[model samples]
Target: MMLTTNEDSQLALECERRIINAWPALSTLVLGDWVLRFANGYSGRANSATPLAYGAELDDAMLDMLEELYRADGLPPTIRLTPLVAEATRAAVLARGYRVKDASFGMIAPLAGLPVSEEAELQIEARPELEWIAGVAARQSGVKTHAGNLAAIVEKVRLPAAFASWLVEGEPVAFGMAVAERGMAEIGLICVDPAHRGKGLGRRIVAGLMGWAGAMDCHSAYLQVEQSNAIAISLYRSLGYRQLYAYETRILD
Candidate 1:
């Protein structure tokens, strides 16, 4: 079992809020402390319901309402279960036959001691441009069809944000972004060209983002990665990021 301190839980909640803000959904409905998000099936993080605040109990009535709302929106009723969720809430979903779908870990690292990268080929942009967006779509298969939605999501980020790209021969080969909220920064949408996988371009992009966040006066950085992605987990661990919490999506099929 994973152990977490009160400070860890609070930080996780803070990161979660930043993530939701940084990646805005097309439509959202707030029921008690739960936030039901819909993004026309673009991405799971933008489409699933998230329990942003703790201590709110989920009863069958609330579950039924959530199901009706999603059904009306042409989306499957999906809930993201995080560490802040109550054990009884998990049981409630299980009783309703919701099965586990995807699991991921929320990771954090302090920006104080991270080494700034010396890569001279990195380019930082105030906003994501066409070239950077196209590079990300070319690398991430899932984002190809949803590129427009992805743009809309990123455009809605109200906080300080930075888009980083690693260039090779004046062409972008890696892409990532950082959004700062309060004293923390959330990194997301990291992708690298297939030909540049083992060449440390991913690390450079991440380091560039962290360096940018540190310059923005952010004390900590956070990111979410699938639990099964060993390569990414290993890379983040090497950069001093530790697992702050784990979350899984439960889908009623």
Candidate 2:
């Protein structure tokens, strides 16, 4: 059953909270523009020896922590806020004269009722064709494909448990990926080759990923998508996925 708007939003928030808490060491660091850059399993000492040493509340800690990030990076700092937490955090940022930008949606599914359309001609693949996937990403985003980008995603799939991909006629078409962690696999990097879109290929690929997650004994799958991508949002909704939360960022002027 499709979730109500309120239910979907709540689910999104819960998913964001879980993801952030699952990897506190990585999630706690604020990157270039207050972006929660690398939060799964990264660890390094902050620039300040006692940046987070105080037992202050989250907001206070974050505010104080921002200075350290700026001092370390030597740049005008920005902050990343997840929509689920934005309401609580926005006032604080505004108080600091920071404005928000770049809002995105966090969509998710429980892997129980993803509709697998029979008519879509989908061919499941065990591994992604790196060159093709990169090419598609580059074309869609106008960015050149780099070896490092491909390598990082490949390494992610090589983790102990991960999701697979789908192709059409031996050509890389769409992909869905997940990283298993703490009883759930956090889905990421789901993309459809623009050339093959509008043919229900995205749904097939997602369905295949859901099936893979279920076979691995995972309880649910989650992913983030930009809120502006209406087509994608609709497709996900048709496949039983729903928004769990929203994240927003404001580029510092």
Candidate 3:
């Protein structure tokens, strides 16, 4: 039994790693002065401080690289960072005069131990209702017209090998997306409609997504959340996500 548990844990960690590598576009690579440049898009190979190698020494090298990239592409000026993990790196950022504007938490849950309540009347759909899913997410996040665009993007990216789920009543109410790449499932853009905030719909959506991942033989799942969002942190904790790490940076405009 103990051996099985250890294997499961290892598998979960591996799955998480794969998910991060799979979705390079949504992934954060480093920090700059004005933009949180993502590894997604036309950005070539990612070269940022690894979780283990990041420290105060990284400040100069990272800043230099960020500046080079910033000038070369004429990208917007902003600091780049992630809410995933970079506690040590983030501390260095704060020491360098970067104030925390927003915060999110990293949360995870083992698929085997998920606590989904059947009483919630939650239903998991295979393909998300792109139109409805995007609208709900945009309204909840205050990103106007983002839903339509996001739906198109998701349709193009989500493959059978990857995992995606929508929490619905008669129509989609919440959505969660994940991809299995390196050996883990990376979860992103989890959203619940404002009208259904307290109804445990978000948890259901996550649970359903995890289930899909598990079905695909994924071992673990991971996500990034802002540090200031305490309510979300609480929800993830309730679902058994412990703090593995923290990441932060400033965005200069």
Error of 3 at 161 (Å): 6.3
Per-candidate Cα lDDT values, in order, are 0.85, 0.52, 0.50
Expressed as tens digits, the lDDT of each residue in 1-253 for candidate 2 is 1235775655554465444433233224532223343312112111111111111123757666765555455534555455433344556666777665456676667766444434344544445556545643554442224434444444444443433445567666666555555445566556777777777766776777666666666677776677788887887788677666555654444
Q: What is the lDDT of residue 222 in candidate 2?
A: 76
| Model 3 accuracy (lDDT, Cα) | 0.50
Which residue runs of candidate 1 sit more than 4 Å off their true CA positions?
A: 113-118
Itemize residue pairs with steric clashes in candidate 1: none
Each candidate structure's TM-score, on Cα atoms with residue i matched to residue i, is: 0.95, 0.66, 0.63
TM-score ranking of the models: 1, 2, 3
Q: Which ten residues in a row have the lowest lDDT in candidate 1?
A: 137-146
List where candidate 3 sits over 4 angstroms from the true fold: 1-22, 26-62, 71-98, 113-129, 142-145, 148-169
Among all candidates shown, the one with the greatest lDDT: 1
lDDT of 2 at 56: 16
